[model samples]
Target: MPPAQSALVVGAGAVGVSCALQLARRGVAVTLIDRGPVGGGTSHGNAGAILRAASPIADPGIVWKVPSMLMDPTGPLAIRWRYLPRLAPWLLRFIVESRPERHRANADAIWLLGDQAPDAWRRQVRGAPAETLLSPVGWLKVYSSEASYRAAEGGRALYRARGAALEEFDAHELRQLEPNLAPIFARGVLHADGLFALNPRRLVELCAEAAVAQGAVIRQAEVVDVEADDARAAVTLADGDRLEADRLVLAAGAWSRGLAEKLGAKVPLETERGYHLMFETPERSLNRPVVWEDKSFVLCPMEHGLRLTSQVELAGLEAPPDFRRVETLIPMARRMLPSLAGAPTDRWLGFRPSLPDARPVVGPSPRAGAALLAFGHQHYGLSLAARTGEVVADMALGVDPGFDPTPLSAARWA
Candidate 1:
C-alpha cells in the first residue's frame, strides 16, 4: 500500500494523540476526533508510572483466584453482579488466557513494547513542555507478606533475564529510600529506569499540543460510526457530519469495540473500570510511586496530590460510577501511609481497554484493508502508548517498524 495522504484517527487520549503525532511527523495529513477534551479518559486518571517492564494481567493462577477476589470487598478486582451476565464471555476467555503458556506469551509481547517505552516517550516529547512532566525517580513495589514476595520469583527472574535495571531492598532499605513511608513492608523491588508523570493529564495535553505543532488537527467530536474498504475509510460524527480519509486508525481505547466491529473485526475487547482518590496533601509526598502489592493499589505522589489508584471492576460503560469501591479502600490506604487524614479531595473513574491475552491489538484490521486497529493495552496503556503509535505510523507510511507486529495482531482471536 502507498503511504496515506490523509488519515482519520478516532480517539484523543494518549494512544490516539500519539498516533496523530507520529503520522503528522511523517508528513501525513491527520485529523484526530474525540468526544471529550484531550486526555479526558483513562489517560487523564492513571497512576502515572511508566514501568521499565510490565507483566500481563493473565498470570497463571489468576483463573483460580477470581472467585475469592470477587467476594472480597477490599480486593483489587470487582464485578457488579448485574453486569456479570454480560461479562461472562469475556471472563471465560480470560480464564483460558491465564494458562501458563498463554500467559508467558502475552507477557513476552507486553515486555517487547514496554522495554522500548522510555526511549519512545522521550522522543515523543523532545523539546516540548511535556518533557518536564516526566520524573526519573523510578517505581517501587513493596510487599507486606513474604508469601506474596516469594510468589513473584518467576516474574523477577524473567525481568532479570531481560536486562531490566532492578534492585531489591530489605524492609530497612525500603524505609531508608522513602523515609515517610511506614516500615511495614517485608521487601521492596525498584525498577531503576522507570518513569513517572507528575501530572498525567497535563502530559497528554502537552503531547497533543506538540502534535498540533507538527500539523495534526485535533477536533472535539464524537465518532458515531465508522466504515472502510480497500480504497478509503470514513467516519460519521454525532451531528450528522461525515468525513473521509485515505486511511483510518481506531485508537478509541475502551469504547473502540463497537467501531471496530463495524469494520468487520470482532475484537474481544472489554472494559476494566478503574478508580482513584486524590488527597491534596503535598506535604505527604513520596520520592517515587509505590505499589502496595499485597493490597493491589498504587500510592503515587503527583503534582496535584497523592493519588490512590486501584480497582478492576467488570462493569460495562453504562454502569454508574461506584465511588464506594475506592472509598472502601481509603482505610487500607491510610494503613499503608498513616499520614493520610480526613476525606479525599477528589475521586475519578475511567475505563481501561483490556484484551483476554493482555496484548493490545495494534496492526491492520484483518478484513478492513484501509483501517488500522490500536487499543487494548490493559494496565499498560500509558506505558506503551508511544511505541504502539510508532508501530501504527510505520504501518500507515508503509515502513517496517523494526519488529514483528504479528504477536500483537487482531487475527490471533480469529
Candidate 2:
C-alpha cells in the first residue's frame, strides 16, 4: 500500500492526540475527531505515572486470586454481579492469558514499547510549554509485609530480564527516600527509569494543540461508524455527517470495539472501569508516585492535589459511577500517607480499553489497508501512548517503525 496523504483519526485522548501529532509531523494532513473536548475522557483522570516498569496485567498469580477478587467487594478487582454473564467470555480469555508463558510473552511485548516511552514522550513535549508535565522522578512501590515483598521477586526478575532498572529499598532506605511516607511500608521498589505527569489533562491538551499547530484539524463530533475500502476510508458522525480521508485511524480507547467491528476486526475488548479520588489540599506532599502493594492503588502528587487512583471494576460502559469505589480509596490513602487526611474533593471514573493478553492493537485493520487500529493499551495506555502513536504514524506513512508489528496487530484475534 502507498503512503497516506490524508488521515482521519477517531478519539482525542492521549493516544489519539499523539497519533495525530506524529502523523502531522510526518506531513500527513490529519483530522482528529472526538465526542468531547480533548483529554476529557480516560486520558484526564489517572494516576499520571508514566510507568516504565509495568508488568503484564495478566499475571499468573491473578489466576489463583480470581475467585477471591470476584467475591470481595473491597478487593482491587471487582465485578458487578449483573455484568457477569456478559463478562464471562472476556474473563475466560483473561484467565487463559494468565498462564506463565502467556504472561511472559505479554510482558515482553509491553516492555518493548514501554522501554521507549519516556524518550518518546520527551520528544513529544520537546520545546512545548507542556514539557513540565513529564517528570523523571521515578515511581515507587511499597510493600507492607515480608511475604508480600517476597512475592514480588518474580516481577522484579521480569524487569531485570527486560533490562529495566529497579532499585530495592529496605524499610529504612525507603523512609529515607520518601521522608513523607508512613512507617507502615516494609519494603520498596523504585523504577528509576519511570516518568510521571504532573497534570495528565494538560499533557493531552498540549499534544492536541501541537497537532493542530502542525496543520492537523480538530473536530468535535461523535463517530458512529467507520467504513473503508481498497481506496479510501470514511467516518460517519452521529449527526449524519460523513468525512473521508485516504487513511483512517481508530484510537477511540474503550469505545473502539464497535468501530473496529465495523471494520471487520472482532477484537475481544473489555472495559476496565478505573476510579480516582483527588484531595483539594493534601496534608503532606509526596516526592513521587507510590503504589501501595497490598491495596493495588497508587498515590501521586499532581498540580491540582494528591490523587489516589486504582481499582478494576469489570462493568460495561453503561454502568453509573460507583462512587463507593472512589470513597474506598480515602481510608487506604490515609493509611499509605497519614498526611492525606483531607476529604476527597473530586472523584472520577473512566473506562480503560483492555484486551485479554494485555497488549494493544497498533497496526492495520484486517478488512482494510486504509484503516489502522491503535487502542486497548489497558493499564499502560498513558505509558505507551507516544510509542504507539509513532508506530501507527509509521504504518500510515509506510515507514519502518523499527520493530515487528505482528504482536500488536489488530488481526491477531482474527
The root-mean-square deviation over C-alpha atoms between each candidate and the true structure, in angstroms, is 1.2, 1.2
Per-prediction TM-score, please? 0.97, 0.98
lDDT of each: 0.89, 0.89
For candidate 1, write residues 28-88 as lDDT tens digits.
Answer: 9999999999999899999998876568788887777888987888898998889889899
Report the C-alpha lDDT of model 2 over 1-414, residue by residue, as the tens digit. 889999999999999999999999999999999999999999999888786745877898988877887676667887888998999999899999999999988887787688898889998889998898888999899999999999989889988887887999999999899988889989999988889999999999999999999999999999988999767999999999999999999999999999999987899999999998888756567989999988888988998888888899998999998878657667767877887776778889999999999898888888888999999989888889998889988989889999887888877798
Locate the minimum summed-lDDT window of 10 residues in model 2.
Answer: 323-332
Candidate 2 lDDT at 126 equals: 92
